[model samples]
Target: MELFEMCPVCQRVCDVQTRRMGTFLSVEQLCPHCQFSRLWNSQPIVRSTPAGNLQLSTSVYVNGESFFKLEKVLKAINLQLFEYDTFLRHAKMFIEPAIVSNFKTSQEMMLRRLSEEDKIIPGGDLWADSPGHSERSGSHTTMDLKINNVVDIPLFKSDEVGGSCQMEKEGLERGLALLQEHGCLDDLMALIFDENFVDPAPFKEEILKVTITEDLCAQDERPVKEEVIESFVTQVKTEAF
Candidate 1:
């Protein structure tokens, strides 16, 4: 069993790593800082150090009496450190909640600040998906506006919320309620959305329910219209016996 050692010239001399495969053994002398490394391969060479007698590389010079190992170690290490960098950049290394929260708070603050300065118009998209191949088991996403900075809302699995598509509508309502709470709904200029989203009568009704201002931008259905964002609020369930 050969033990790995440090570059011997590191800030804190420590053990370098070795990866072994059967009879073939590989060792590295890696620097803690500059990340320079010298790879060596050889049959386990036993030598004496101040620490104790240990197995190391036969190629490395120790005393005047140097004996060669029957086995030879291949000396090759790629100059580019892509392997090390890719491993370090892996997604699993991230703390998801902290990252999400940090960005979420920053974006919300930015939107609020912008709204205060100008009548910032925002839009929203409602997303729905069923992972389990059942409507009841599907999930719904809240309104996400590509315009103003997006607010991160936690996903609600349908199973957890009575397995209903209605939750998606609720998510839309939740976003509208948020804007209302911020006291910026009255400044809403225009909203654009797909025509099939709902009936025009109910669509107008839903808008009036949360109407903060009298002027609801209305126009004749154009044969061709530029893309507009849909900003709608769904009804919230009231608890009653």
Candidate 2:
């Protein structure tokens, strides 16, 4: 601030002007005696967009942070920030597409690796956006139990499945369908699910009939004692390891 407030030509105090755009600051200094002037910016402009502004917006979104909360923090600190509209624009124009593309690439690589395996055992679970059967959306995620790597994640909307209660079923069905499409079902030995998950009667009757049935049928279980469940899980983990 001090350096920018002085004029080099006359070694005197100069009039300083500041313009703020989002996280970027522009400072201009002018000397009345020599009529000398200079301008400086705190950040570089990339294609007419402030680099810091775009960086802050992208970082907040990719890190699962709330822009509204960040805005409040910046305001409390008297720092300059872009508006919500700009943040949304950045997300729509750049961040979301990048995320989607990266996800597809990673999933494709994982599926390709699984295609080479003779047997694959994946553990899956459904998680809802909200508690109980009133959730608006659900995510079904499957992980390779052998490698402990996530294989796939399918998201389902309640409206598409008639009601929120059916979101879990929809997510499960979609995940299975995706695996089938990728030819991973041919190598799938067991499909592990949470003990409390809704029984997949449809899968037993329709999907698993002819495709890798032996191990899956062996794993199909009814409610049992807590100790038994723990023992079975331990056995499965030992085999996987």
Candidate 3:
């Protein structure tokens, strides 16, 4: 009998012999580090869609200074604006809250609504169960909301601007090399960003005004979606590998 099987959590060869009381199968799998349960289970059904046929549409705005250069750079890198958007959404998840707070405002609001008994107005009952509905008859509490203040943070800082400049230069150099090797530069560029460059200054200002309100009833720590993390990890791994 095989003594071990690959541990999915740690990606390591682990003991397969079961020692626990409820063990029935000859094979017992166990992770040494995290003690995650090793179970002899059926392989999950994997469903995949055709990559090329899956169409995705997205748009991003670039500053005038880097507009043309960015287009050239993206073509060289074998990536589109949508791919960058995917990467950025992933990157933002891990960004330090201190950095986030610097450009964001944390707001706490107290929501108090009249109870069914306190419905002195005509539609008090409607609103009573609306915003601050409490199961225990009468309750009032404050909810905290955090919002990213885009205006507080400049898109490009003088000191950190070099990093962005270097990344674009390197991305273009690499992308161009790949395109030249693959002979897809002209074709890919023609397909991507074919539209005229629209100014983003006005829209960016509007986005900065958006705010996030926290649900008071929800637990303090919200669950992070696994799909988001997995997609982020896959993107990083693809880039690194």
Best by lDDT: 2
lDDT of 1 by residue, 77-168 (tens): 31111122322232223324445677778857854764575454445554556433354433233333445456535456566665465666
Q: lDDT: which is higher, 1 or 2?
A: 2
Query: Candidate 2: how many backbone clashes?
Result: 0
Model 1 local distance difference test score: 0.46
Clashing pairs in 1: 41-73, 192-228, 192-229, 192-230
Q: Local distance difference test, per candidate?
A: 0.46, 0.83, 0.37
> How well does each candidate superpose onto the true structure, as a TM-score?
0.36, 0.65, 0.15
Q: Model 3: how far is 176 from its true place, Å?
A: 2.3
- Writing each residue's lDDT as its tens digit, candidate 3 over 1-241 gives 3436667787776766642111112245777876766455222211332122111111222111433465567679865432444334423543334346643442111111111122111100111222332221211221111221111111222233243233333333433343334333334443234423456789999999999777896757665799789999999999998
lDDT of 3 at 9: 83
Q: How many clashing residue pairs are found in candidate 1?
A: 4
TM-score of 2: 0.65
